[model samples]
Each structure stands twice: as C-alpha cells, then as structure tokens.
Target chain A: MSLETLSENRSFGGTQGVYRHKSQATGTDMTFGLFMPELAEHARVPVLWYLSGLTCTHENAMTKAAAQQLCADAGIAIVFPDTSPRGDDVADDEAYDLGKGAGFYVNATQDPWKPHFQMWHYIVHELPELLGDNFAVDRDRMGITGHSMGGHGALTIAMTHPERYKSVSAFAPIANPTESDWGRKQLGAYLGSDESAWRAHDSTVLMTEKGYPGEILIDQGSSDQFLDLLKPESLAHAMMARRQSGQFRMQPGYDHSYFFVQTFMNDHVMWHTERLI
Target chain B: MSLETLSENRSFGGTQGVYRHKSQATGTDMTFGLFMPELAEHARVPVLWYLSGLTCTHENAMTKAAAQQLCADAGIAIVFPDTSPRGDDVADDEAYDLGKGAGFYVNATQDPWKPHFQMWHYIVHELPELLGDNFAVDRDRMGITGHSMGGHGALTIAMTHPERYKSVSAFAPIANPTESDWGRKQLGAYLGSDESAWRAHDSTVLMTEKGYPGEILIDQGSSDQFLDLLKPESLAHAMMARRQSGQFRMQPGYDHSYFFVQTFMNDHVMWHTERLI
Candidate 1:
C-alpha cells in the first residue's frame, strides 16, 4: 500500500486524481489517473478501467477523451493506467511500438524485457488490489475497456477472467493481435518467437474458442490510418462464428485518435454502467 | 492569406483543426486551433474565441477544455489562439510569465518585445480578419471567453470593442492586472514602466469605467492557487459599482486548471449561444 497522491482536481462534480505507487509486479514506480464521481460517502461503486495505446500514458485519455462528464453522469468511476512499466532501469527500445510506452499488456518472457515488462501481472493482479484496498471500488462489478493495444488487453483479460469483469468495450482496438503486424512484432519480442504463445492473447482466438457470455462492445474507426494493423473485421468474424453477443461498430470518417474516442465515449460509459449495475 | 493547415480531426460532429500562418502583426509564424461545428456546406456561424493562459499554446484548450461537443451542440465555433508569438528569433524570458507564451494580449511598446510582441493586434485584428476571410464565420455574432491571463484579455477586448463582441465571459481572470503580481510583471515588461498605460488593459478598470453593455459572465474558482492574483472579488465590486449586467460566480473547491473551466464550459457555451443567436 505504498501509494502516493500526486494531484486531484474537482471535475464535473467528480474527483480527477493522479497517483503514484510502488508497483510490485514491474519493480518500478507506476502512475495512473482515476476519476471518481460524487457518490454517497464511503459508497462502493462499480469501476471501469481504460487502457491507453502506444505513445500514451495515463494523461492522454484522462485529459483528452472528455470521459469524466459522461462517466460522472453514468455513476461509474473510470481508471486510466499507464501503458507500460517505465524507469531508467527498465528496458526500452528505439521503436515506439516496443519500448516503454508500448507495454502490449503482457508479461515479457524474453530477456532484456522480462525484468520489468510485466504489465499483465501489474494490471490484472497488482493494480486491482490497490484500487480495491484504497478506493471505493466494488470488486464484483468491475468493467474493462481500452484503446488500440489496450483494446487487445481488455478482450484477452476479460476472456481470461470472465468472472472478474462484468463488461468489456474498446475504441479502435486491435482485435486479432496474433495476426496483426503490431501484435506479432510486440508478441514475438515479449513472449518469444512462438506464434502459439500469442493465441492466448488474441481476442479473435478467445472469442472463437473460449467465449465469454458477458457484455462486449467494440468501436473501430473506418478512416483509421492504422486500420490494417487493428484487423477488427477478423474479430467480428470470430464473434459471428462463436455467436458472441458483442457490439461491433465501424464508425465512418473517424480516425484513430482521442477525437474519435470522445465522440463515442458516452455510449461506452453508459453501456458499461448499465451492464455493471 | 498565408495560412496553412497543420492537422484536422472530426470531433463531436465538427472539425477540429490546427493551422499556421505568417502573422504580420507579430512578424512570426503563429499557430492556432479552430473547431468548426457541422454546418450547411457554406453556412456562416457564430464564433467564440478562447484565449489560453501563460505557458500555453492553442493545444491546451483544444485538447483539454472539453469545449467542442458543447459548442457543436450550441451551433457556435470556438477558436484557441496561442498565448504569444513564438519563434527562435523572437525574444523570450526565463520566467514563465513574461516572455514567449506570456504576451499579456497587449501590443508591446518596449524594446526587444515591440517588434514581435503585437499579440493585441494579432488577436483582435489579424486573426479575426483572417478567420472571417477564410472560414464560415458570422462576423456580426462573435463572443469571447478565456482562462487566467487570457481571461484578462477577453474582458478588456470585449469592453474595448463592445460593439464587435456579442457576448463575453472569463474563468479566474486577473481582474485588476495593474495591482496583480503576475499582471504587473508581465504588463510592466511588455508595455514599459508607465503604470497609467496599463489601465487600458486592466479588466476591472474597463468594467468599472468603460462598461460593456452586452452579456457578461465570469466563473472564478475559490480554491485557485493564484486566487490572490486573480481578485475576482474586485471585478464583482466593479460590476456592482457600475451596475454592469454580468453574472459572477465563485465556484467552491475548484482550482485554476482546465478542470474548473471544463466543469463549467457547457454553461459558458450556452450563455454565449443565447446572446449570439
């Protein structure tokens, strides 16, 4: 419980806060943003976790997504966790897709990354425990969503722990990471060159094979510059094949940016709120 | 006419764009953000100008203020101009308040700043003319609002050109800039040792002496760290003395960040929209 409060602001009748903690899973100090709406004092509330994509920290979604007002209106707390474990001692790469800001939400099995690139453990085990112990988080009614690489994380994580998360959603998410260039490169680097090891992390694979009955939503931008890298259609195909009741939307003229996310963020918040409640 | 597009994104049924142009007034290439809500292909719309604070660029309000959706809903455009003219050749100071990003929205009369620090001309004349010439702008229906130093700018500009601006608003403005530490330092540096000359730029003086008969609104945070420097109470006193038609509110527990502005942004947008319409 070595957590520290960094800054807190009153936003939309809610508390927008940034905090730092000594993370056990990554062996590095981690920072995250939490937006908790005005609730009855000491009331436990359902929380939705939002994972950011490449070259993003907790600040990007927390500041740019315009999510607080919508989330506050929906009566849910939203969390923005850093994309990767970061520090001077932590391993990094010159490439934006593989380095500190690109965690890929997986435990690194390869050397030069194994020591500190353990975001899977940090997100699934360490961060949740921290929130549950320190904040008014209702552990039984938690939801998950993310953008891009974080989208892949949300799907795999929700499928992996179907009982832990109540609902899932994403914005321009990487649906079939095993088949995506971005996913294949990061997976090869973090989980070794074995393609079989990546199947467990791919949402298409999970939906087709080990499906979850919980609520699911995915919004992808039709005009996204990285559309091919996301391969959301592949996941849509898998969802159809497995009869997974997931909402898949291809938003036209929207790109892969917070602008696109902010436009549809209210829907996601409302969706999660209804399901969690 | 020397304008260039930097970037553009579709947001909340509008277009968020960044543009650059060689500014004759500042003698520098200036950048600004413009959010044009969806309109009939060639329909002109009312515009609300938002001036940023010290050490800030157009990006702060464009990305963080949560202004677009509200503006789009209200059928108004919003412009975010940088705090000051910026370039390697432009004079700058070590202090956050005095140099590049702290133009005080005044045309400098002093050396080293006079040549390039013509933000007053740039903002009030050059930018507006450019906007009117290039965009779907309804020149007759313009409103202005800003935060911190930019608040001071909005008040003074609207009062100086009351016939030009249909509505005016501010957030945590330095009311009496001549009496404020940040304002005195910045104004003194930019306009020289003539304290009497600074009266033209002081919002409190403008409100008290040359009253703005149009719609006026001010939202100040009580918990702002720089509350002493802002002196919203002074403006409230001036409003009372002059019988000015202004709505002034002290928001409790809110700070001077975008958090406060965003919390009340919808109200501002609606207020301006009614008057402009």
Candidate 2:
C-alpha cells in the first residue's frame, strides 16, 4: 500500500497527484494519475478508473481527456494508470499492437512476458487494494471506462468481476478480439495458439457464454478506421441471442480518436453518475 | 490567396485541417488550425482566433484545447496560429524566452528580429484577409482569445484594431508585460529600451489609454506559479482607472498550467458563444 509521489500540481481547488508503486503481481513499478476533488469537510468520494489505449502513458488521458470537471461535479476521483509496464528491463516488441503497449489486460503464462505482463492482476486485484488503502475512495461505488484497446480492457475486467465494478462503459472497443488481426496476433503471442484460451478475453464471446449481471453500454464511431476490427454488431448479436438487454450506440461519421471520445465523454460520465448514485 | 493543406483528419463528422500560408507581413510560412463543422449546405460561420503562449507550436493548442465540440455547438471555426515563426534561417536566441517564443505580438524595430518578427501585422492584417478570401468566415463576426503571452497578444491586438474584432477574452494572461522580467527583456530586445514603445504592446497600458470598445473577459488562477509576472491587477487597475466595464474572475487553488485552462475552458467557450450568437 506504500505510494511514492512522482509529481503534483494544483487545478481548480483540487490536487492532481502522480504516484508510483511497486507491484507484486507484475514485479514492475506502476504509475497512476489520481485527482483528489475539492471535497466538503472530511467527506470521502466515489471513484472511477479510466484505462488508456496503446502507445499511451498515464499522462495522456489525465492531461488530454476533459473528464475532470464532470468528476469534480459528481464528487468522484479519477485514477489513470499507464497502459503497460515500460522500461529497458521489461521485454518488448517492435510492433505497436503487441508487447509493451499491448498488455491486452491479461496475466500472461507465456515465456519472456510471464514475469511483468500481468496487467489483469495489477488492474483488477492490486490497483483497487492500493487505492482503497491510500486514498479516500468509496470502493462500493466504483465504475470503469476506456478507449480502443483499453475499452477491451474495461469490458473484460468488468464482465469477469461484476461485483468489483458497479458500472461499465467503453468507446470504440474491440468487441471480438479473437476474430480481429490485432487481437489474434497479440493473443497468440501472449496466450499461445490455443483458440479456446482467446475466448476468455473476447467480450463478444464472453457475453454469449456468460451474460453480464448488469447492463453494458458501448459507444462506437461509424467512420472509425478500425471499425472492422471493433465488431460492435457481433457484440449486439451475441447479447440478443442470449436475450441480454444492454445499450449499444453507433455514432455516425466519427472516428477512433480522442476527438470522438471527447464528443461522447460527458455522456459516459453522466451515465456512470446515474448508476453510481 | 493560395492555401496549402498541411494535414487533415476526420473527427466528429467534420474535418480538422491544418494549413500553411505564405504570410505577406513576415514573408515566412505561417500555420493555423481550421475546424470545419459538419457542413450542412455550406453556411458561413463566425471565426475565433486562438493565440498560444511561449514555446508552443500551432499544433499544441489545436490538438490539446478540446475546444472543437463547443465551437461546433456554437457553429464557430477556430484558428490557432503558431506563437512565432521558426526555422534555422530565422533568428533565434539561446534562451526559450527571448528570440523566437517572445514575439510579444509586436513589430520588432530592433536588430535581428526586425526582418521576421512581424506577428502583429501577420495576425491583425494578413491572417484575416487570407481567411476571409479563402474560407467561409464572416469578416465582421471575428473574436480573439489567448493564454499567458498570447493573452497579452489578444488584448493588445484587439485594442489596437478595435474595428476588426467583435469580442475578446483570455485565460491566465499577462496583463502588463512592461513590468515583468520576461516582458521587459523581450520588449527591450524586440523594440529597444524605450518605455513609450513598450506601451503599445502592454495590455494594461493600452486599456488605460485606448480602452476596448467591447467587454473584456479574463480568468486567472490564484495558485499560479507565475503570479508575480502576470500582474492581473495591473489590467484591473487600468480598467478601473478608465471606468471600463470588464469581467475579471480569480479562481482559488488553480495553477498556471493547461490543467487550469481545461477546468474553466467551457466558460470561455460559452462566453464567446453568447457574444458570437
């Protein structure tokens, strides 16, 4: 539960703190952005976990994403973690979609990656314990959302452990990772060639096999460059086949980018607010 | 007016086009960001000029501001200009503040800078003319805003040419450059050590002498690290001395960073929206 302050700055009567903690799960140092809202006399607040996509650091979402105002208004603290462990010591690949940038939110049992690529364990198990122990976060009212590869992280994490997260949403998520090239490559490299092992990480397959206890919301752009890889319809079809009711929206003419995310970001915040309240 | 498209990307059913045009004032290539809203049959829209601070390129404010959604809602096109012209051929000082970044939005009559540091003419005359001829911006419905040094730019530019801009605003702006070290060094180097010459570039002095015809709005952070250099009260005192009606708000516990800007950015956008509409 020990946390070391990496950096801190003041904004809108709140403190934006960047902290680093040694993780036992991944055996690597992890960084996260925590914004403690200006609260009324000694009142603890709800928390929201935001995951980012490939080739991103903890600072990207914290600095660029205009989500703090909503979080402040809703009395929620936001936690932003680095996409994956990054250092000269950790194993990496040249491709942008695999190795360091592409943790895919799973505990790898494979060689080279087995030591420090346990993002699933770090995010789901260790992160919550550290946040609850160190910060004033109401763990009972937690929610999660992310973009692209991180969207896949949010979905898989929430579906696997619904009790831990009260609400869930995503933007331009890779709905079926096993069927997409980016997903297949990463999964084959990290989880081996066994197709059965891939299903546990695919949201569409997971939804079809084990229906989520609560409603899931997803927002995708019609003009996304990776629209073929996202496969939102497959997720919808799977939900419908299982008689599962959830909200899946397809926005017209938007793309897979921060601009698209910023357009619909406030809506996701409000959505989580309604459920968390 | 020849326009060269430097880059273009699809976001939110519209396109973000970055263009480089040969400026008649500086005789150097200048860049600006244009957000063309989802065009519903080609309607002319109001234009907003966003000037950046020290050591920033045109791309910084364009990509990081998150001002597109509000602009789209207000049906306004935003233009972000680089803080200063830059090239190996162009004049540069060893420090980050003096030669290139410290354009001060004035026509330099001093050595080295005189040949190319004509941002004043580039912004006030050349930019509007080129934009009016090529883009669908209403020439009469233009507004201006900026941050820190750029804030000084907006105020001075608007005050200098009152007929051109309809409204003006700023975030964490330098009110009086004549009194601060950064400003004194820059103005002295760019315009020589004459106090009267520096008055034309100082917003506080201009406010006391010429006075803006329209209402001026400014937002300052209480916890700003550069509060000594900013001197918001100088502008406030000048406004008071002239009985000029303007809005100057100071928020508590905010620093002199983009995080502070992002917090109250919606207010500035809405303020311009009210004026534009």
Candidate 3:
C-alpha cells in the first residue's frame, strides 16, 4: 500500500514522522507515527510497536511517551498505530469508551463496527507488512507494548502471535478485560454476549489457557483511577495458576496517565531491545 | 497569594504539578507548570525557568519538551510559564501573534493589552516570589531558557537581571526581534512606537548596548522556517562586537518545533546545572 507523509520532525537524533495510508483491514484511511532512529539510515533495525490507550490518536504516545531517546540509543524503530479507525464516515459511538478511539485492538464481529473496526487485523497483519515494505525495519526482531486498552491489545496480540514479537510489555493494562466492567461493556458491544469469544481477546484468559513461553512484563500504577477495572491482580493470579513466567510490578504513587508511562519508558524500551538483540 | 493546585502527576521521579494564582502584574489568574525534582523535598534545589514559544500553553513543554528526566537527573526544578495570559475576561486578538497567546514577554505600554499583558513583571518579579514561597527553590541559583518568542524573553530577561539567573540559553530565539517582523509587530503594540523601548527587549540590541556578563548559549536550527526572522547571526555579531562570551550553534536538520527543543534539552539542562552547582 502507498503511504502519504503527513509530517516529520527531527527528534532525539531521529526522524519522528506521521504517515497516512489506505488500510485494507480497517477499510479506512489510517494514520500512524513512525520514528526512525539515525541508525536506521545505514541498516535495518529492530522494530517495536506501541499501541496507544483509549481516546488517543497516534499523536499521544508520539508527543507524551518520551521513548525516542531510549529507542535511539537502543537502535530500534518504534511505530505507533492510532487506537481506532477515524473519519466522518466511520461508525462512531457518542461515548468515548465504545467507539472511534476505542478499537480495543479487536476485529469486531458486530454491525456498525465490523465494517471499519478491524484493528486486530490492521495492527497484527497490515501494519507490520506496510512498515517492512516501506521502512528500514526488521520483521524478524519485532516487539510490542502499550498502555491501558493498547496494553490489552499488546498482550493478546503477542500471546496469539509469539513468533511475530520477541518481547512483550504493558503499562497500566486492562489485564482481564472479559471480567472488568470496561471489558464487559466493550466486548458485549463488539463481540456480543458470547462470553467464550471474549476469552480469546482477554489477556488473563489467554495466559491461563494458551500460556506464553516468554516472560511478559507489566507495570501497574497503584494509584490508577481505573485500577479496579484494570484488574491486573487477576492476570498475576492466572499466570501463577498456569505456572507461567511473568513480571508484574505495582508502582507506588503513580496514576493511569502518560506521566506514569513516560517514567518507565526507558526500562520498557531497553527490555525489548535486549530481547530483540 | 494562595495558589490552587490545578493538577499534579509523578513524572521522572519528580512531581509535575500545575498551579494557578492571581497575578498582580497581569491582573489575571496565571497558571504555570512546576516540576519539583525529588531532591527538592530535601534541599532547596536550583530552579530553571522555561518560557514556551507563541501559541503554546504551559502544557506544551510539560508534555513535548521531554526535559523532566534530564532535569530530574541534574537535580534541578524546572518551571514552565504560559506564553501569555489567558481567560475570557482578558483582552485578546484574533491573530495568533498578538493579544492572548503572544504577550511577547514584555509589559504592554499600549491600549487593549496594557492591563493584562505585563508578562515582563509577572516573570521577573511575581513568579519568582511565588515559586520561592510555595516551593523548595533556591532563588539565588536560577537559570532561564526558552524557544522562539520565549527565547527572546529568556535572553532579554536574563540580560537585564544577570544577578538573578546564573546561566542563560535559547533555542531558535528571535534574537533581534526589533529588527524582525514578528518582533516589530509585537514590540510596537506592547512598547509603543518608541524604538528605544524596543531595544531593551531585543537581544541583539541589548547585547550590543549592554553586554551580558558570563557566557550565553544559543542553538538555531538551519532548517527552521523562521530563520530569516530570527537572525541568530545578528546576535552573534553583536556579542562579538561587545566581546561578550556567547556560543551560537546552528543545527543542520532541525526545525522550529518542540522536537528541536527536546533534542538539545539535555545539553541545555546540564549547562545550566553545571553553572548552578
């Protein structure tokens, strides 16, 4: 697919750019942020995918994550896909939690959303191909991470496609979305009342049932306003029940904002870089 | 004056807080971002003031500048002041370069802006006192830096109050605003037609007339669209004519954006911290 360069800026010794492309999976014009480190100019580098939380465009993590310096040092290229498909014609709900910016990184099976909310196929399949074909990215050494809703996407996507991403991590992720109110409402709307269908997209359920071979890293803020809805503890319990290796850290005095994400961004980038290398 | 804590978040082992208080100089409620390094709780740490460019709120640098981690490591408390006074009651112009978001960091001596555009007094006098009284900041060990219009403000303010700020630097600053269109338009409206008043606010003119003590650092991006209007070379020439110690660097691929500011933010913070220590 042909991509349009929306804007580009020199940031942290890298080219931080935004691009627009016609996506087959989403059936819409999708935009994503791509940051190419100076090292990418000379050789292919390990690529990391960052999915943003609800109500965020590609700009949120691009502007707020503070990950470029670390990624530059690690010689990694990071791509940030928008949370959901956007545009006037796309089906959107008035509430922020259900539509537009809240794709939940799943292929919708319901009407009004199924037509344009195939973010699962978009991020997992189409986006990586587009980046590999157009940019200096090594498809073999890919890693994935995100915050909140995007975190759910990261875990489930990584769990289901272990061969695609070498490392996986998240910040304040909605671990057991099938059990939480946020997850129930979104899953109910998009996947209908079939509880079993929701289990495939739920990280906690995926971990207990499918079990990831690699250790998954997660950072949960104790002060997150949506901590109850996130239910990170449930994921920990599931990992323990399955005897799966996972690292879950509860950060004190932090919240469910970019401020929290940026504080530990260095650690996440380095974690992925070490594994990718 | 009592300050209302608008919001606070933990960032980079520091508290990134926004506060609002009634300002006597601007005759309005002014808000500023205060990043209190963890060291500040134990000691009165050195303070660094960051003035943003035109059409930016204090939040721009807070989110985009990516300076917190560096500042935190350097044990410096950074404060970001809004570009101009804002509110419904305050006087404003439709044009972005004038009125509300473009206070020019000077005391307005003309109509429509005189009452609430006294950013000069607000930054130099009232802001320092407020920070000192409300936070753990060392008034004697302070530094100032900015970008574009804010860079002009930093140069002039630091030049005039050399005893207050220990070090000064700017990124893509309008060095000789009096000689540039943006400067001429803003200075004319704020300081009236008296060209003499404009000289004090122009860094090039000020350096030539009253040379700054110690060294000043400036970084100008070669690809900056407003390079002609900024005239960093003019200031370099004036500094040389006066035998003033100033270092001016032209970055090759950078532009006039927060990306450029964040690129060199570490160098600037370390530069200021070295002098402060």
DockQ of 1: 0.01
The lowest-lDDT stretch of 10 consecutive residues in candidate 3 chain A is A239-248
lDDT of 2 by residue, A40-75 (tens): 226777788888887877888888778877777777
Candidate 3 deviant stretches above 4 angstroms: B1-277
Residue pairs in candidate 3 whose N, alpha carbon or C atoms collide under 3 angstroms: none
DockQ of 3: 0.01
| Residue B257 lDDT (model 2) | 82
lDDT string for model 3 (B223-242, tens) is 78887788766775565335
Candidate 2 global lDDT:
0.81
Error at B111, model 3, angstroms:
94
lDDT of 2 at B240: 37
Name the weakest run of 10 consecutive residues (lDDT summed) in model 2 chain A.
A239-248
Cα error, residue B203 of model 1, in Å, equals 0.7
Residue B197's lDDT within candidate 2 is 88
What is candidate 1's CAPRI-style docking category based on DockQ? incorrect
